[model samples]
Target: MAPHTHIKSVHTLSPIDPWWKRNLVTYHPTPKKSRHIKVPWWSRKCAAALQAKRHAFAAWRKNPTPPLRQRFHYLEAQCKRVILDEKRLAWASFCASLSFSISVSQAWSFFRKMVHPQPPLTFQ
Candidate 1:
């Protein structure tokens, strides 16, 4: 013979609480702006030169010839020189725009920006 079982009554939940009031739901604030950004300083010409240098490097790797190797080295040096020259020119222009009455903090900030240009920033 099968055993008999008794049914138990269950209590219903009172009501559903708001999502914001739930314990598992967390509130995250939206990001309006970034605290810091990294800006690229590579100009179109500089970028093209660098790409050409990379291509030269790959070609030299396949052929391993004296001419190809020399060309690669030449392009590498030229690209580096161009990048540095652009940075120097930019810094010179920035310094030229500054007046003689600016605070030291401002000068330092400007110098930092010149060293590392950040995006979302407008240079004066």
Candidate 2:
């Protein structure tokens, strides 16, 4: 019958379904991480070569013909060569960018990164 008693009854906390639990249950979402990690030396050319090699390998796997097998091997080799070239070019450019113009600290940072690359981020 009292006003304070009425307010307390209206705002009473229940144990069956807490407000925080309701919110957490309603907020199911996808992971906010990237699917593909970018490699320093990865390029469109390398992607194209790898795609071609995958296709060749699939084709060879379906029908085990000698020609298809050879084609797959050739594409695999081409992909490796392209990837190596890209890595070499990337390293050369990075080294070229570091010169007498850069400060000692920057040069040392560059050298450290080149010597010990950071580990890629992983999502479980």
Per-residue lDDT, model 1, residue 97, is 75
| TM of each candidate vs. truth | 0.52, 0.59
Looking at candidate 1, the ten consecutive residues that score lowest on lDDT are 4-13
Give one clash count per candidate, in the order shown. Answer: 0, 0
Candidate with top TM-score is: 2
lDDT of 2 by residue, 1-124 (tens): 2222222332253565365345544673435767444456667787788888989999999999999999999999998898779778878997878777889896665555444442223211
lDDT measured at residue 26 in model 1 versus the true structure, 0 to 100: 49
Residues 22-61 of candidate 1: C-alpha lDDT, one tens digit per residue: 4222453334765654333446766677788889999999
Superposed by TM-score, candidate 2 places the C-alpha of residue 20 at a distance from the truth, in angstroms, of 12
Cα deviation in Å at residue 81, candidate 1? 1.6
| TM-score for candidate 2 | 0.59
State the TM-score for model 1: 0.52
